[model samples]
Target: MPHIIIEHSASLDTDFSQLLKSIHQSTIDTNLFDASTIKTRRVAFPQCILGDGKTDFVHVQVHLLAGRTQTQKQHLSESLLNTLRTLLSDSVSLSVHPYDLDPAIYRKN
Candidate 1:
């Protein structure tokens, strides 16, 4: 199972619902997970400061059960990052980090 959590600055003008759909589709394009199983959500920071105080940001963290090969993980990360690059402005700080959850401890129920 994988959970896509998106964190962004509230000041940024973007449609998060569409972003979620785009990311979910990109994840499906990787052929790593079923479309029905992918979970996506977003959290906007209304009060926060970026490094330069003028930069807005969007950071995506993908958490999944640990087992995927490094190449697969890298591909997932790059694919998601590329999606962000196309949607967000150049001035926005964008990043994608894929985290492997311990399969032994991760539970959905």
Candidate 2:
């Protein structure tokens, strides 16, 4: 019942491994659930369709699957957004979406 979805701009020079590690560690440190049970998915878009260059926006969506209390979810969302903002260049715009779902439906045997 715990899953995390993270989406970011493809243009950003991101270290996927490090990001995953950070999320994993944070989830564990929060003591909200079993670290092993945590599930995270990250997607980066190479090219995004923005509104006539009105805003340089990068969409980031994070879904916490299970064992996340309401407060925990809020904290995670904030932490993730802050992390991305710091990691990305100032020229690029960043946006984060907090979502949730059941992992069982997306799990692979």
TM-score against truth, every candidate: 0.93, 0.63
What are the clashing pairs of model 1?
none
What TM-score does model 1 achieve against the real structure?
0.93
Clashes of 2: 6
- For model 2, how does the per-residue alpha-carbon lDDT over 26-100 read when each residue is reduced to its tens digit? 656666667787786777767776654523454556555655678877876677666656655676666656677
Off by over 4 Å in 2: 51-60, 65-69, 102-109
Model 1 CA deviation exceeding 4 Å by range = 52-54
lDDT of 1: 0.89
Task: Report, for every candidate in turn, its global Cα lDDT versus the true structure.
Answer: 0.89, 0.63
- C-alpha RMSD values across all candidates: 1.2, 3.7
